[model samples]
Target: MSDDGVRWLDEDQQHHWRALVMGTTLLFDRLDNDLSREHGISLAEYEILVRLSEREGRRMRMAQLADSMAHSRSRVTHTVGRLEKSGLVERIKSPEDGRGVVCAMTEQGWELLVAMAPTHVRGVRDNLVDLADPADFAAVGRVFDAVADHLVAAHPEMEIRGH
Candidate 1:
């Protein structure tokens, strides 16, 4: 700790931290651009589609979807609205309860997802996965898992496990 009681990162730590930031920014931009150019979808929208596909019946409640993605409800709503406009997804009243809304993937959405899966996976592998040794990539996963767990612990409402 310094005299003012601040515990700043050391030189190596600073270097690594900056690298993480820059790497993530560039990697995400590249992935987003690839998807946009080839498939005409943004990475964020693709992530929503992927999440919905992983759920039972290819649907999830709006609130659950937002929580699962660590996004705000309004943001999810807006994105889903755009998807609905494109005929990719539909928002319906939740069957479990008549109150909440559920976002369901349409057949068109499923087909598009199927078609774009390869492009997305290739982009991921080309940009990130294949760049690191298996053990080093596994370590990166572990580090992010710990970071997510710690952050979510402090905000229990944002926790998405088992949802």
Candidate 2:
């Protein structure tokens, strides 16, 4: 390594970071896997539904949706198409922009979200929230906020929504 005075991660910090990442990843893996198996929906599909359900008229512009979901335009397009086929979403021309498209949650999609929200919440609490103490959980929230801010500052052109 270059003799730059920049110090590497301390052993404790490295171990802590690795454990945090691996543990969270494994938790999400199990949650998503079980969710998909039981509910016939993947985590991505659930997130899309949640986004649409929370939007005005359960609708949002394609670009905004992509931003909210942290997905590329093409990936969002493909996923939206699949959701549309499953009768969980609908796509239409944007009223605000002539050349743009929008994604809206359908009646079936709302029903699905309503059905799954409770189970999903339980899975989240069980896998992550309940496992962390209050102080640690608060710290985790702050960490995510800082990370998101850093990312936004680094990539001003990329639309990334935390809310």
Runs of candidate 1 with Cα error greater than 4 angstroms are: 154-163
CA error at residue 21 for candidate 2, angstroms:
2.0
Query: Best TM-score goes to which candidate?
Result: 1
Clashing pairs in 2: none
Model 1's alpha-carbon lDDT is 0.89
Q: Using Cα atoms with residue i matched to residue i, what is each candidate's TM-score against the true structure?
A: 0.94, 0.88
lDDT (tens digit, per residue) of candidate 1 on 9-71? 999999999999999999999989998999899898998999999878999999888887889
- Model 2 C-alpha RMSD vs. true structure (Å) is 3.1
Candidate 2 per-residue C-alpha lDDT over 126-149 given as tens digits, one digit per residue, 9 for 90 to 100 = 888998899999998888777866
Which ten residues in a row are the worst by lDDT in model 2?
154-163
